[model samples]
Target: MMPETFLSWWQFNNARGKQPDMSNKCPPVLHVPAAGEQAQRLAALSQTFISAFTQQPQFFTRAPGRVNLIGEHVDYCGYAVFPMAVEQDILVAVAINTSGRLNICNVDANFPPYSCDINNYEINKERPVWHNYILSGVRGIQDEGGMQQPFIGINMAVTGNVPPSSGLSSSSALVCASALGMAHSHGLSLSQETLAEICARCERHVGTQGGGMDQAIAFLATKDTAKLIEFNPLQATSVTLPPGATFVVANCLAPMNKAANSYFNCRVMECRLATQVMAKKAGLPWRTFQKLGDLQRALDKTLLQMITLVEDSFEVRPYSKRQVCELLNTTPDELNQVSLSENTRHIQEFKLHDRALHVFSEAHRVWEFKKVCVEGGAYALHTLGRLMQESHKSTQLLYECSHPKLDTLVELSKGLALGARLTGAGWGGCMVALVEEDKVEQYKEHLWKSYYSKEAAAEGRPRNTLLFSSPPGPGACVFVK
Candidate 1:
């Protein structure tokens, strides 16, 4: 019955031309391929699942990794982000088991198999366990009251192509796939928006203060189109790219795990503190404002106005803990208790000014980028490219998240690509570049000789693993036979 219902939903969605509403009753369907590359991939994955678990998979859930085209580090600021799903994604092949336990294995032997009772399990936060991501989704659904019926155990074989810790959103992809798998296994129905919100909140259990761009894109992205993902209401509007434009993603080969360290959370805390400080200076209830966008709304000011306020209210230098407490009119103890995150409470200084500056500037760039995309012309691509370049500069200088290797990549790509920038939380991840369609091969070859080839030769490593040319791909879906 569950398999038939899932297939019926998939057939219904496909019959409707692939555009579905966000109603609560209708479950989101996965891509059902008739005959093509996707069909081949699905067949191969199904075979692997059967070989590993010794049973045919009921259904497969897929969630794509994303690349931020223009908006960087602004999603949590309550600003719109420009991101599109990439070809790389996580695929989970699942079958129900009556054993009342989740038996999970990864196709890559590097990740060990994990097993536990489906209804009772804990996520290990201190260690970077691979299966903990799946557990996060399961726990998310359980907490969201999706387990009204008796818990159904599952056998899952997970596999993915998204590079880990390279800022292409591999972790979020896994979590989204797991959430979808759990929903299907239990015969649960969920809208894309509901699942996106749930997955975003539950991923916090992994200890990364993420802004929901990855999860949103994973759930909402459409084929060959970028999304203007706005927060507060959590809606996505499709933004078509310019004609004959190509985007290339190049990994700097440095992995920055947001959960393993406090850098990502530290930035989040700084932005939160900045908003509170600004609200206090304006004589509003500072504690009520957690995001920079909220403060802007409260003041009814434009992005430029908010930039001015940041310049006027905060100094360029780092603000000491004492200074922040004094500005907010609170004690250090009270500040730690109320304002700071668990990981950032021990830090003594904050870069409030720089963080605020970056948020406001980046938010403005996002709108400008959308405008150029909407009004496509001969120079539209160039204008968008220039905005991306400026965005990278702000992330590098003001936000201080860009790594030296990323900077080197951007600099080296200056002549080859129209514009290049770090696409994620920065600090050693992948950089996305806007290149013309004809120049894509040329750009890749140039990068190979200049960056990948030289680095591989010098370090005695492989060159092909570091770079990729990504086209926009579809969002989350279940693949059925």
Candidate 2:
């Protein structure tokens, strides 16, 4: 069924000349639910928009946050990642205006209100505020559409349930929802694949060098399945999760804002450096290689072989700047210019051996995870759980991304959960656990008593939000009036 979004686009394009039909490729459009909790929330959101702008909204867009069941920190390495969308999401109430200015307000008063000329706004990388994420989406669409005329300005009222900075991808969902609203406003009908790619690239404007996993899953997810999202062309394949498996996510109450610090980009740079060093050793042009996955393809080696290569090529000790420079046959300045990001350019040492090992092994774990899910059996859950445990260990020991609090949560889930691991960039965030359907309540209560109840930060927050089971939910979509 063609949603109002596509129908409106078809009507708009008919006047301007025909455009490619992308109905199947675009996000599904559905009527706003007439009753139930979603309807109530959207109804309240519509009223919030009217109260803020004194006019009815044109439409609404939603983009869900995701949980990476496995495959952590491997997307930027150009490897496939397994992630499923969650029920929590960011929703925007949007209306077009001829004022040529963007007006943005948040339902939560903490954000306050923001405005800028539609054609004149810059995303603040140094101190990115909430609206900067929305602006990033607008800017991305503007760049992609390249309209000669200024885009009709938009008024947006934003509300989200996804916990911010707790690594459930709250930031990416905002960018995607905003992007979807902007595209629909302009009568542009881009495919979901195109939108996901654009949002992924544009979110970097906020200065976090993330792999595309979050954004890819934001758009490509379906209602009841997890997706194996591959990069270098961005394809998603549905993988049925083993039956009777329930995934529970628990926030450690520690928030790591990726763009606000250097940890995330530091890891990215380390991976790049490792890939280059490996390439240089293999007689391949090191400068041309950035992702370990690319290097693996060039060498025509399996993931296991790459792990072996990592062991043989480097020591467990961190590589000093001088050591890396000498190995690459380049000076420190050249190394910084070629391989490092602005945030990671300063005095540094890199743990190349462990980082490369984590990435290669984690990539292999993703494949193993897919295999176990595809070939489900009595032992499938046990095997998948073991793979998850191994992935977490690699993230903790080798990647060095897991937080103490995150590790504590994982540790707390030891006997109750099949396996648990930190789910996002993980300098401090949330952990996802594979729990059986029958054990979900028991698992959550165990964590609450052992972890959340004692934490001062989780005080006064709803227990369900802090600890809940998240099945694979639907991808991003639009709800039109």
- Using TM-score, give the best candidate's number: 2
lDDT of 2 by residue, 1-481 (tens): 2344654564576448533244878988878889987788898888889998887887899999999999999999999999999999999999876567899988898998999998898888998688889988998898884455678778999999999998999999999999998887776778889999999999989998888999999999999999999998999999999998799999999989988989999999999999999999999999999999999999999999999999999998999988999899999889989999998999579999999999999999999999999989999988988999999999999999999999999899889899999999998989999998898888888898888888999999999788888779998888976
Weakest ten-residue segment in model 1 by summed lDDT? 18-27
lDDT per model vs. reference = 0.86, 0.90
The TM-score, computed over Cα atoms with residue i paired to residue i, of candidate 2 is: 0.95
C-alpha lDDT (0 to 100) for residue 145 of candidate 2: 48
**In terms of TM-score, how similar is model 1 to the real structure?**
0.92
Candidate 1 regions with alpha-carbon error over 4 angstroms = 1-37, 457-465
- Per-residue lDDT of 257 in model 1: 85
For residue 125, model 2's alpha carbon misses the true position, in angstroms, by 0.6
Judging by lDDT against the true structure, name the best candidate: 2
Query: Clashes in model 2: which pairs?
Result: none
